[model samples]
Target chain A: MIDPIDLQLIVAIQEGLPIVARPYKIIAGQLDLEEQEIIERLSRLKQQGLIKRLGVIVKHRRLGYQSNAMVVFDMPDKLVKQKGEQISQLAFINLCYLRPRRGELWPYNLFCMIHGKSRELVLQQLTQLIDSCALNDYPYDILFSTRCFKQRGAIYSIDK
Target chain B: MLSILHKQLLNNFQQEFPLSPRPFQDIANILGVSEDEVLSAYRELDKLQFISRIGPVIQPNYIGLSTLIAMQVPGEQLSAVASIVNHFPEVNHNYEREHLFNLWFVLIADDEHHLQTVITGIEGKTGIKTMQLPLLEDYFINLGFQLDLEDNHQSESVCT
Candidate 1:
């Protein structure tokens, strides 16, 4: 579990780091802590795997990655780990996960996201992924994102 | 229409963004550009919504609980249901996809109870059943995407 100060620090910068020469210094000032302390804490968090990534969060759609498809597969339970790892290694696959199936309503247990410049490119990549992985037998579906109602960094309430 | 400097910053600095007193200056030194140039480029990127932010991508279920949820809202009520779902601060990403379960979102909360509360609240408000698909295993360690800016085919549709 993270301490209170660390939680506060995470909350402070979770939204974003100020786009300035000394962003850390700005965060330090906000928390009334030394700049070095803020840096060290963040470094420690990253090391602990609490912070998965620390960097530029690009808006892919605006960067010409217009096709966003969430590809899910209903794989045999045992094959999920192997197949998920294999699919995650592909350069075009942005996100991959193993999720639980909810009976017949949701039969997919594996999910991956592919973002590309166009629908054709995304489809080609999906085809390549399927052929290379030998996933012909597994039932799969590609749900292309039509609209983004909202998108933002997660907000953590300290009160919890 | 991204400048060379902008492309370099977007592609290379997605991960390992400097954690120092003058982080932008560090990036500037590496890119062979002035600190002000890097800062302004990033400022413009943020202004144009090309980059969302420079911050830590917290690991799921690390600081708080999170789940991927899907709901099948009728086409007519899609916008209204989305508005209700977007009302909660916990709901970070809400998207309309092409599927039976057309509306999908991600919710993060301080704990399991809070997460469930938000889910239940949304169900009550929208009157649509939600299928929670929390992460059983994450196959990829997010290193950030390495963008290929050479073939820049910007989409005609504006995503707002």
Candidate 2:
């Protein structure tokens, strides 16, 4: 079970941390706790796998990476494990995972999300990835996002 | 294109941001800049949505059930359907993609039963067929993109 202060910490940083030297100290002051306490709680939260990693989230679109595609592959179950690992190692692939196939309508099991400056570049990279990774035989489709309705870090407000 | 300092911040902090109480101070010291400078720069970056947030990115499927869902909505009802999906607390990311299955969203629920219930509820409300793609195997995720700050160009600021 998470303590109240821990939940408070998550809520506070849900949007972001303040851009200050002593960010935790400032948060501690607001929460009426010592700086060390905030640091310790955060560390524990991370260790417990509740918090994955603390880092910067660069907006890819803002960095001229406007073209993004979700590539789904119809991979045989036997080869998925081996191929998924290889695909994930490729430099341009940001997210690569395997999802369950949904019968005839959706036959894809392996999925990857790739981003580039333009659609042509993204497709070029995908073609190269397919050839280099020997993934040419697999049937796949790419879905390019037209608009982002909402995007944010997961909220842990739901009772665990 | 980004300024030298902005580039430095993105390059350094994207992966291994300091976990210290005075992390900004550490960054300032590393860049030979004042704490205020680092603070204000980050503030501007956040305001501009250059970075979504500076914190821990939770590992999906670790805490709750999550799935990628896609729906085919008429173009005229796109906004309305998107708003409906956005209203769900379980949804973290939602988007409109250029495909027959246009609207896509990621939903996180406490368990499989809950996930199914939510999917059913969404289908009933939207009167659209929904496709569920649950993760079967994850090979890689949360990879940060490295930007070449040499261009020194940024998108035109959108006045709020």
Candidate 3:
């Protein structure tokens, strides 16, 4: 747990960091502290792993490229970690994970995000990447992102 | 002067709230604090990394577009290509996952043509081909992290 003063500082960072010249400076003024204090507290928070990163968010669908998919693989249990690392190294894969595999319904254990300009290009790379991995030895399926009902950032309200 | 109650007041804002002209007053009533107190605390929380942004997630498909693109960038060049992908505001969330495709990032644009232009731009800059995989269908849900309970595995073996 943190004291109220530090907690207040955290609250400000979470609510919204201003986007302007010297954003931290503006935040420091709002908190009635020096810029150095805001920077120090944020650095500590980041080091502690409470704060992941601070940056702008882009609305993807509104932009274009409008197709997104999650490709899952039924990777051998032995190769989970190694294979996950390999996939993560791909510049195109934004999200990658190793979920516990279920039965035939959810047989995929490895997941990666793939995006492209056209459907043809997306599939072409998919085939090539799989072929390179000799992934034919394993079973997989691609789950596309059809709709995004509610997508938001993390909430830090649990003080109990 | 201030204590845990203040923490509760700030976190509650990030979660669920009824937006009205006098939102601060309403929150003050619930937390048993003065309206000015709630407002002041809010300004403080904004200084910390506790909250990223406070706004409705605008739809992506409305104006421009986006795709969950994937690319298998060379490990040595992953960071370089990622920076290229992120140069445009079109890119939203990017991550290094555990898979063959090492780099993953979301690209949003004003239209399909723009998405393509961005992809081409990235390809030219990095000299690495991009695979844009758009989702076909989505089943099984939940995006936001659960706060009320422990990490209860859904579908018993679903991916994160």
The residue-by-residue lDDT of candidate 1 on B80-119, one tens digit each, is 9999999898997899999999999999988899989999
- What stretches of model 3 exceed 4 Å from their correct place? A1-160, B1-3, B6-11, B136-144, B148-160
Off by over 4 Å in 1: B153-160
The DockQ-derived docking category for candidate 2 is medium
Clashing pairs for model 1 are none
Q: What local lDDT does model 3 show for residue A158? A: 20
User: So what's the TM-score on candidate 3?
Assistant: 0.47
Candidate 3, residues B7-84, lDDT tens digits: the string is 465335543332333445777798888777766665554443233354322223422456666677787777677777
Interface residue Cα RMSD of candidate 1 after superposition: 1.6
Show model 2 residue runs off by greater than 4 Å: A1-8, A29-32, A44-50, A158-160, B150-160
**Cα misplacement distance, residue B119 of candidate 2 (Å):** 2.2
- Residue B146 in candidate 3 has what lDDT? 17
Candidate-wise lDDT, in order: 0.90, 0.81, 0.55
| Cα shift from native, residue B10, model 1 (Å) | 0.5
Residue-wise C-alpha lDDT for candidate 1, range A17-42, written one tens digit per residue: 99877889899999999999999999
Better of 1 and 3 by lDDT: 1
Residues A20-58 of candidate 2 have per-residue lDDT tens digits of: 778888888888989998888888877786676677887
Winner of 2 and 3 under lDDT: 2
Model 1: docking quality category: medium
Task: Report the C-alpha displacement of residue A135, candidate 1, in angstroms.
Answer: 1.3
Cα displacement (Å) at residue B61, model 2: 2.3
